[model samples]
Each structure stands twice: as C-alpha cells, then as structure tokens.
Target chain A: MTDRSQLPAIRQQVTELVLAGSPEHAEEAINETAEKFGDLAVVEVLGELEPQVASLHLSSFDGGKMSLATLLIPPKAWAESLAYFAATWDEDWIEDEPEVLAESLFAHIHGMVFGTDDEERRAELLNAALATDWGTTAFAVLFSTAAEEIIEIANDIHNLGAHRSGSTTSDHDVIPMALEIARTNEEGWDRILFEIFPDWRPGENELHAASEEESDDDLGDEEARESEFAMGRSTKELLLRLRKQVPSKAVAPAKKGARPSLGEDIFS
Target chain B: MNITSYTARTPQLVQALEALGQRADEQAAGILFDELCGITALVAKKFTNDRTAEGIHEAFHLTVGCISLAISQADIADTGEAKLSFLLQHGAEYVFQMGFRHIKELSALPYTAFVSDFDNDPFVQQRNLKAIFMEICSADPATTWSGDAVYQNEIVDRKRNQHIIDCGKWLRKHNAAGVVRDSEMDANAAITVAVLFALSGDGRIVARTAQRPLENLIAHIRDTKPDVDASWDKFLKKIPPEFQPLLRERMEQLRGTIVKKLYGKTKPKTLLTELQDHYIGSEQDIDYA
Candidate 1:
C-alpha cells in the first residue's frame, strides 16, 4: 500500500476530481492509481471517498448524471474487484470495506426495474436515467464497494433492468467475461456469495437457532424454508445444478482488489 | 438446479426454461439470464400488494434467479448489436403475459406492437407514475400531507426519501371511498413501522418497542428540527393512534445515514461521514438502481 499517511490526501484529490473535474478526469486518476499502485489502493481510496462524494450529492448532482452508473474499470478491474470481495470479510476491511456490501442491491422495491417505455416517453425516461446518474457517477455510487452481485446483475440487466429502449453494457465488456469465469470457478462463487450475502451465510447464528427449532414437527416446514433461505442453501443448491447446466470451463478470479483481468479472450 | 424446482408451469414457459438450458456459451447464458432476470423486476412490481412486496419480490427474483443463476456466476460473451430495445420488448411480453390484460388496446395488439404502446402507458412509466400519484395525493383535500409544493417538488425532482415517507402517509390515509379498510389497516400499520425502520437505520423499530422510546423520539425530532416536524404533521397520524410513536421514532433515527455502504465504513471514525450523516431535506435522491 502507499504510505498510510498519504491516503487522506489521495482521497481528497479523488473527491475533488469527482466533483470539480469531469468524471472522466476523476476516473482517469483512479484508473491511473490502479495501474501504478494496483487495485487495493484505488479500492481503498474509493471506499473512503465514496461517502465523501455521497455528501456532495448536491455539489456533484450535475456531473454525476454523466458519472452515475458509469463504471470506471481500468483493465481487469472487474476481476480484481471480485478478488477483494472475499477480503472484505477479513477484519481489517470492515473499517473501509464493510459487510453491508453483501446485502441484496434491491432494497428499494421499484428501483429494481424501469417500467417499459414507448416512443413518446422513451426520450423522457432515457433522460431520467442519465439524470439519475446511470453513467459514471452511478458506477462510483454502486460499484466502489465492489458489490459483485450488483456488478453481475448490471452486466445483463441493462442498468438494473431500466430497459431503456437502446441501452448498452455500461461496464467494460470484460466484466461479463470476468463474471462468467468467476461464477464457474469454485472459489470465485464462494467469494462472490460471501461478498453478496454475508448475513445469510450458513454459519450465522440465526440459522443455527432456527435449525435447532426445526426439530419440532409442527414448525418444521416453515423453519426449514426460512433456514434454507437464511443459509442460502437453496441458492447454493440451484448453483450446484447450474454448475452442470452452464458450460464454461472454470477460470479463477484475478487475485488483487479492483484489478480487471483483461485477457485477449475478454476482447474476443 | 433440479429442473423440477419450478413445476406446474404452462408448457410454453416450461419449454422456454428447457431451451434456456441449451445455452452452453458463458456469454450466451449470461446475456439470456441478464435479460430474463432483469425483465423479472419490471414484471414483479405488478404483483405487489401493500404487504407481500417482499415475499413476491423474492419469489419472482428466485424464479428467474434459479433458471439463470449460472449466468451470474458464468462468463461474458463477445459484443454484438445492441439489444437494448429487446429488453423492453421482452419485458412487455412477459408483463403482458402476466399483467396489462386489463388494457383493451394493449390486449388487442400482438406483443411486438404492445412494446411501443406499453411504453406510452402512464402506469408503466416512472416519470408518469410519480406525477400521477402526486396529483392524486395533492388534489385530494382530505389527505394530510397536502396543500404544498414541497411534496410535489420532491416527487417531481425524483427525490425518493420523501417519496417513501409520503407512501407511508398515503397507505395510512383513507382511499377513494374515504375510509381505511379493515383488511388494509393491519397492512398499513406494518408498512408504517417498516418505513420507520427503513428510514431510521435501526432495526429495533421493527422489533417490538416499548412506548417511552417513541415519545422521546417524537419530542427529539420536534425539538431538533421543528420545521421538518410541521411538515411531518406527526405524519404517522393516519396510522393507528397507538403506532404513531413507533414510526415517529424511526423518522427521527439516523435520519439520513445512507444505510447501505457508506455508513458502515465511515460512521465510526470519519468526520466526513459525520457531516454526511445529517439529513438535508433530500434535495438529492440516491437510488441504488
């Protein structure tokens, strides 16, 4: 890591770039840092700085329209981001890469999808997405924590399923490629799930208590279903089935935080 | 993983599920899954009632989730033509197959034609829905949070925090008949607390609470930001009189902590977060999607 003392200065500089300069300028600086110092440093600076940016929503609102949902992936940034997801569980990261990173990204009910649009309102809704920051500011808002599940969803869902009539992939194409590889990799699934659903993981105490409660015949079905959801057992089961169903040869996730594994294969 | 995970489906959907399995390329599976899964969110909202939004949300999520779980964990495909329009196309087809049956024009058209028509439907458009709902709430003289541009401004501007609070107020208020339904009263109360818990950044509001905590919170918010309180109208007023204190407590709790990622990382130590934690009247709206 760069000198720990220097971290705040880097954060302030990035925040200034995010607010004052074009998002491209801010992101370029972030990407440059990833190249020079690697993913961990940039992720660290971003995790600290995103909240600072969050504070400046009033300040960054206009530029953020362009910035929001715009992911700043420098090379294999997606793969490297996944690599650090597992690390967020480590005690050290809680200060910067907290566990709430794992919660299902769909907390707000309707935020899940854009209602279908027709020609007249299409431009209106399209402008709304941009105004809402489905661009660069969006990636900074959503992805800075390296929420793998949201990233995975964003790849296919087309801006969290807003279904803008002609929207395209927001992240580097390598993300979908990276997600496919990581999902197929045994360890990668663990890291991704660990990053996505920290509270629901099997070892959590509530599941154990519920499992003990399951012995009662009357409570059995309800508790079992609850336990299953809590443990992510059903998801694990479905994924196990998917392991057979999906045809990808498993490839490992890249090791460093925020690093994108931009293989020639990703390009092709 | 068991194909039987979803059963008793109509043959067409069943056939589609099986065909979906034919996707061997990581990219193809990912694209198909992303498309199917993304469209589900648009369709899922159709099924929401006051109470079961969470339950059905998970159900629709899992339905698409299991069929396409592999894509989330799999590979990316080579780029081709932008299929952005297909998302709305398929999304409309799926919702029509499930919803929009009531619209005469939509029902008469084939799925392709409905895509454009569906886009124009006010109910489906986010911008339209907010304006329509706000007009409903604002035009009604009987409702409480009425008579002001503040609510309209927030809704028009797409500031979701106030909109969420407004939803709780509306759910508690009387409907078209001007009476809160007995069946819905229970759901309304649950929504009140849920809204409180969500906005407050504390789960305790959802857990059963003693009475004193709430009264103190109402008093605190009233004292601290009395201007906001006048706007709040002890906004929980429409819910059961007994539950007002509970919702009030949450409205005052951690008012704008940005609950998901920022608070956890910086809440404890960073002065920046401390400043960020204060609630501005939500001139800024931050939706995760």
Candidate 2:
C-alpha cells in the first residue's frame, strides 16, 4: 500500500481536479492513486475526504441523469480515468484486481457520510446507492456488517421512501443480499420481514386485513383500484407466508434510543 | 463435440416436424401465428432443399401453435404476445431446438386439431404450455445442448413458475366470482390446474393451493358435461395418484348431492330437465353452491 502520509497529497490533487470543474480528471487522479496505493489506501483516502469528493458534480452535458450529487459521474469519463490509471499499474494487479473499486470507493464514502450513528440516513443512502446499481464490491462492503446493522438497513429501505424513480435498484436486488446476511444469524426472519414489509410487527395483521377489506368494496374507481392492485396479490401472499414462518417473540424490540415502532403507533 | 453431435437425430427431428404438421389447421393470425411463420421461414433457410425441412418447418409452426394454444387455454395473463415475441426473438435458436425436440409430446394430445379449429375452443383451453416446454427441455440430453439454450430455458422456466405462483396467490386472495370472470383470471385458473398436473408429487407448497380452484373447475365441468363419467375419467387421469382418490370421493359426493336434489321422491325428470334445473344457475352462484 502507498504510505499513509501520501494520502493528503493525493486528496489535494483530486480536490484540485474537482474544483476545476473536471470530475473526470478527479476520478482519474483517484483511480491512479488507487492503483499505486491499492484499494484499501484508496478507500481510506476516499472515506476521509468523502464529503468533498461526493459533492463534485458533472456538467449537464455529461448525461447528468442521476441526482446531481450522486457518486455515479458519467461512465465515459470514469472509464477513461480508470483506463489511464490501469495502464500505470503492474500486470500482476490485473489478476486480483477489484473490478468495482470505483463503486466500492463510492459506497465507503456513503458509509462515512451516512455513518452508522444515524440509522435512517444510512439506510436512505444505502438504498439510493443500490438504486443506482452498486456493483458486487459495494454490496459486500455495505451488507457484510453485523446482523443488527443489516436488519436496520433492511427496515430503513422498506420503511423509507427510498425507491426514487429512474433508479435501477429494486427490492428484488436488495432482498437476496439482505436475506443472505440474515440467514447467517438466529434472528434472520426478523431481518427478512423488515426488508419485506416496512411496517411489519409481532401479531400485527393490519396491512393484509386492510387489503382484504379494500378488495371487497366495489372497485369502481379505476385509479384507486389500480393503486390497490399495484400492492401485488402475490407479494401479500408471500408476506403472509413469511409472517407464518416468523415467531411472534422474534419481533425486535424498539431500539433503546430509536423512535417508537410503526406498529405500536398504528395499534395505539 | 462435432457439429453433427449438436444436430438432433433425424428421427427426433422428424417426429418434432410431424407434430407441427398437426397444427396446420390453426389459422394464420395474431402475433403468435406471425412468429410461427417467421421461425418457419428462418429454419427453412437452413435446409432449403431437404424435403425433411418441410417437416421441421411444420414442427416449428406446431410448436408455436401449441404454445399459443397453451397460453390462451391457461389464461396466462403475463405471457402474452409481447412476452412470446420477446422469447421468440431473443431465444430464437433455443426455442426452435426445444420445439423440434418436444413438438411430438405437445402434439401427442389427441384433440390438437379439434382444439386448434376454433379461436375459442374449450377443449384446448387452459393447458400450461410453459410447464410442458420445461418438461420437454428437461428430458433432453444436456451434453448436446448449448449453455445459452439451457440458461435461457432456466430463465423462461423461472419466469413461468413465478407467473403461475403469482397467479395462484392472486386467485387465493380474490373471490372466485370476481376473479373467474376476468379472462386472465380464468387463464390463471387453467394454468394452475395444468401446473398442478405437471408438478404433482414435486411437493411445492404453491401447488397444494391449486386444489380449491381445481375443485371449482371440476364442478364447472360437471355442470357442463352431458357425459359426466367420461369427463370425470379424462379429468381423473391427469390428477396425481395420491390426489385421485380424494378427488374421486369428492366428485361422488358432489354427484350424489346433485342426484338427490334433482330427483327427490317425485317422478324422475328427463336428463335434460335435470340439467336445466340443476346446472342453469348463474356462474357466480355455482361457486356459492
């Protein structure tokens, strides 16, 4: 790895490129530093200087489809920057190269900004990142944490309005990763349920019951009916099945300092 | 492996082609029929001079017809023209090969002509062509098939299964009357029945839920059929061995109740009178009964 002292200089160079309105150049500097120092060094630098790096925005002409503040700068620039940096690296680096280092670096930055302290913001960032097709490295970095952290992430994604339109990330993409983490621990289903039903709680059958009642009423209003129908029948059935699998006692109590449970609020 | 090994044996290919010939009665219309024509034309280009190519072409046509029929019969809501078109266009070669190998099994149905003759043939109604395709492909020698073909088939099978499971869940959620009235719902019911037959003894939990819809369907069949014994016999043959006895007992109970209600101690009415009296109730009312 590159010496720890060199990171400040590298960050300064990247920051200069960004200040010059050339994120493409900034990305190149970062990738070059990554190849020279290794992914860990690059991650450390990126993590420390995350706020400034994340704040760098591409020109509108550079296909600014994502949220302006997003880490996914234009692919062509990112690719060119990586290509230049990759040329300088040894051939040996190719064999065990982190293919999605760029995405991982961004994810780490996200982790730092939306640090573990604020559960809600952390989840929102994770979901938003996922929405933009975070590569395998990003998924590994974010989700390979503790089960409680994983559950919190799942709950935040499920409960928060994280599915920003035009994002490629889906619940389908997120679930299997969360489920894999959940499977490793005893309170796995709680995590799985948190991911599935945003407002899931022990012995709470409100959503299913409400859906049933809505279905029975005359569905003359097309928009309302369509909206109701959009809450997929199969999804409800799968939720019910998952609910059956979960023991009522397994419902995670409210976090010591966290907000009251959605279920508690509803039921009360 | 040599190119020859990749090519299917002549007999299997011929059998597949002959199966396609059986669907010649299907009128040329709709997206499926157009696809059948496109596939036939493409396959024909490969072996233009070979007389056997004609058979292969027919097989392609029949395979498409069978799928189209199966989707329509099963009331498969999601696997509409667009999905079929996408599959045919993207996985053209795999589909063609699959159709060539499995056309015979699909065409083995004795009533192919009868069913294909009508735009809305009840006899051809509600078959799970996706499951049939999966079963046919599953039996083929994996060594001879391309990885893309196998992977594509897996994707198709997964999507098809998910669709059926979704349909089953939807059916379970909604009332029979509200659901059965929709063409897609009816198709879903038929698909569920076809899936139940295909996946019998596979121990899928989703398959078990098919029982209620299947029971409702059997009742409908009983109401419609003039020869209940013949219809029941045909229906029972499709059911798995374990479920057959239970179904038979249920059917008998149903028949007995209908008989007692219709005949009573009064002079027995004609069969037509009984049919009119007992079976002429509204479709919605039948489920309640």
Candidate 3:
C-alpha cells in the first residue's frame, strides 16, 4: 500500500490540479488515489477541500469523470462571491449554454447542506443560501424538495390512511419511523423550515426576477407570479399528515389552527 | 412549481457527446447519464413547452434513480446481463419521455381521484400509491423513505422485486426469456445444440442479433444455480494454457456487465420489465429488415 501519510500531500496536489482549470487531471489523480486508498479515503480528502480553491472545481467541471468531485465541493465562500451563489441557485437564469445545469447545481447544494455532521454549519449554509437571492429563495427550493419527498414517503407509510391487515400496524410502519427520520436530519429541516423560512414569497431578488431584466412586452400581472408560490395542494396535505402523525419543528403549519387551551372550556 | 426554462444550446452536453464519440462501449456506460441528459432535452423540446433546463435535469435524475433501484434489486447480472439489453432496446429519448411524463403527473394526480374516499379496488390503490412513491425515494435529501427496516424488507421490497422483473422481461420476445425449468432441452442436448448453433453463423451467440437469446441463456444459468463459482477457479487447471486468456476475458466481461460473484458461493438472480402500452408511438417502430 502507498504510505498513508502521503495522502494529505496527494489531496493538496489534487486541489492544485483543480485550481489550474484541469479537472481531467484531478479526476485521474482521484481515481488513482481511490485504487490505493479505497473510495472513503478519497471522499474524506475531497470533502476537506479548501472551500475557496475548490469552488473552481465546480466552475471548471466539464465532461470529466470528476462529476463526483464537483458534487462534493463546498459552495464558494460568502466572502468570495454572492454573485457566484446567485448564479448557481438563481430561479430565473436563462443561459445560452449553461455551464451548470439546475439538477447538478441543486445536487451540489444538497451536498453542501449535509457536508458536515455539525448542525451549525448546515444552518449557516442554509441561511446564506436563503439570504443570497429572493428569486426561488433557498427556502422555496428546499421546501419544494421536502414537499415532493414527503408526499412520496407518505404513500409508502400511510397506505391511503387505512390500517393494514393482520400483522401490520402503523406503529411498526410509518409514524415512529417518520419521527426517527425527521430526527436524523436535525441539522437541516424542521427548525430550518419553521424558523428561517418565514416567507414563501420571498419576492424576486435582483438576479432571478425576470420582469425587471426583460422588456415590458414580456410582462405578466403580479397575480400569475404570486399563484406559483401557493404550494401544491397534495404537498400541503402530506405536510399536514406529517405534522399530525409526527410533530416536529421541521414541519411547517400551512395555516395556524385555532389557539390552544388547557381544556376545551378553558378559553370559553 | 416546477422550474421551467429552455436552452437550445448546452455546451457541456455537446462536450459529453463529443467525448462519447471517441470512447468504447465499456467507457460509454460511465457517461451514459450525461449523454442521456443532452439527448433527452433535444428530443423532449419537440413534444412539450413546459420543460426547463432544471426540470429536464431533475426528471432524468429521478428516472435514473428509479432505474438504478431496479438494477440493484433485479436478478440481472451472475444473474445475467438481460436487464442491460432491456435498457438498450429503448431509444434514450423514449426513457426520458417517460420521466417528463412523470413530472406532469406529480401535481395532477390524474390516475388517483383526489378525493381520498378509498377506491373499492385494492389493485387500483396499489397502483396509485406505488406511482406516488416512485415520485420520491431515499435518493432525495428531502425525504425519509429509508428510515424503517420493516418498511423496506416487508413492504417496499415486494415493489422492488416486481419492478426489475417487469424491466427485465418487457423488451424480450414474449417466450425468449424465462425460468430455466421451462427450457425445452436437457443439458446434453442443449450443449450439442448450442455448439451447432454456434457453427451456424446466423445463430452464433456473439452476433448483434443474438442479444436476446444470449441474455436468456444467462438467465437460465442463474436460475439453474450450478455450483460453478466453486468449480470456476479449478476449471482453469484443465484448460490448455493458450485458450485460458479467452476464458478469463469472457468471464471478466460477464462480471463487469451482467453476472456477479461468478466464482462465489451464492446463486444469482434474474430481472425483467414491461413498457406501458401508451408509451408506444405508431411511427417509431424500427425496420427489422
């Protein structure tokens, strides 16, 4: 086996290759390192990428096999450029030839959200993304993701709100599991959704709002744009189910219920 | 709302196409996801205006995620490469069109009556729930589908097994692939016939047209569960030195593509699949001649 100590130097070497705008070389280096150290070693090294220098990894990402590396790199630091973050997460971009596609960029953002086991780091990343652009703000993008996922997961667990026959029980099946899964993501979700994401209609940031950039002929009424943020009805139902079945801070209240009381007659 | 925008020019995809141009079939598989993305967008623009660069990108990711799950659970490879052929039969655009279609169905819930009054038909409920479930899964950072072991082993697995079987069988000539017990010949006769078939150029297993039959035989090997993995290492002792390379190369190829743990302790599994009748377009049939 190669000397274990040299791995740090190799990681540094790979970082330099990435900075030089030669992603292909970096990929080859990683693949070689993987053969010697196994995938986990390289994944650890890549995850330790200098957040600023490694930003070039995504910028220069092309058709090389470094798709995995581009995926793992942290977002460009806040001090480095909000414009860069805006470009990656912007809701209204129309590139003639997009160097980065929405799917890949979102995958990177998802990676950034969970990159550290540290809950505080995830919150910091989420907060920065939310603050960067009002157009399809980070909250909207992540909520849309959570909304779609909740509906899908509900199908497996809810069984159409009917109890299963014989040995099956909802206790064994969905709720406890949902609560546990909700807990697994203590870093992101629940608190992040409820606390940081107060506005569904964060309104258009200068970058992603199209009307300001486009001519008047392309204009539509404010009503059409506002309608997009109403949230999908089925998604709303699933979140409701989640809040009811497994209450947590990650869950958002679609509409606040009547004020609570110790007893039904207490308020009366 | 789905992110919707369009760009006719995608330089990264263009680069993927050019890179694929100089690569081998083995190498091409690695870049297939990227290659499919570009091809899907180009093909999709003809059919719908709702697509955004982001929508198409995410749609393909979901579709491939479903495909990967099917592949992982299927008795596809030491089981057999039958499923990969199953993949190859469809034009890339067709697979992607299914994905874009899924995106539309997500909010519409067209198949399920939005009214939650349970349908009297249990199968209808199963169909609708699975359809909804496919719309999300463990791959998403957003969902908790992977949290429960019972949900996976007891509930989700039945869905998994059926999906790959459907994919594995859907494209084959209806009877060409199946359980080994159904094979018409006994082992000795099958061996003789296989040799004779190889002697005849039209029936050679290595030819382009024999893709289905070859996959079928591999499926049979998996089902039959011959203790080949135990014997595979020792068998090399009997082979003449000159031809050993050929046998090793062939085994390696199968290991890389279809069959798994070839010389290991376990019996392999087989996979199959079906296409929705609606996915078929009238004019798109290939000319067999």
Going through the candidates in order, what is the number of backbone clashes in each? 30, 5, 23
lDDT of 3 at B280: 14
Against the true structure, candidate 3 reaches a TM-score of 0.24
**Regions of candidate 1 where Cα sits further than 4 Å from its true position:** A1-48, A52-268, B1-11, B25-28, B50-53, B58-289
lDDT of 3 by residue, A175-253 (tens): 3323332344433333333332332332331111122233233337444544553223222222222223221234333
Candidate 3 residue A109 C-alpha distance from true site, Å: 5.0
Instruction: Give the share of true interchain contacts found in each model.
Output: 0.00, 0.00, 0.00
Tens digits of per-residue lDDT for model 2, B1-289: 5656433322222233344455453432233344445555543443232257655644453444433322222322332344344333433334444443443333233321111233245543324333344334322222232322333354455554444434444433443234333222322333323333222222222222222443443344344533555545665555446545544554465556544433234232343244334432111223323
Worst 10 residues of 1 chain B by lDDT: B138-147
TM-score result, candidate 1? 0.17
Off by over 4 Å in 2: A16-21, A55-175, A184-199, A203-268, B1-289
> How well does chain A score by TM in each candidate?
0.25, 0.32, 0.39
TM-score of every model?
A: 0.17, 0.20, 0.24
Which candidate would rank higher by TM-score, 2 or 3? 3
**CA shift at B267, candidate 2, in angstroms?**
99
Candidate 3 scores an iRMS of 25.6
Worst 10 residues of 3 chain A by lDDT: A259-268
Candidate 3, residue B15: Cα displacement in angstroms equals: 49
The Cα RMSD in angstroms, rounded to one decimal, for candidate 3 relative to the true structure is 31.0
Q: What does the lDDT read for residue B178 in candidate 3?
A: 33
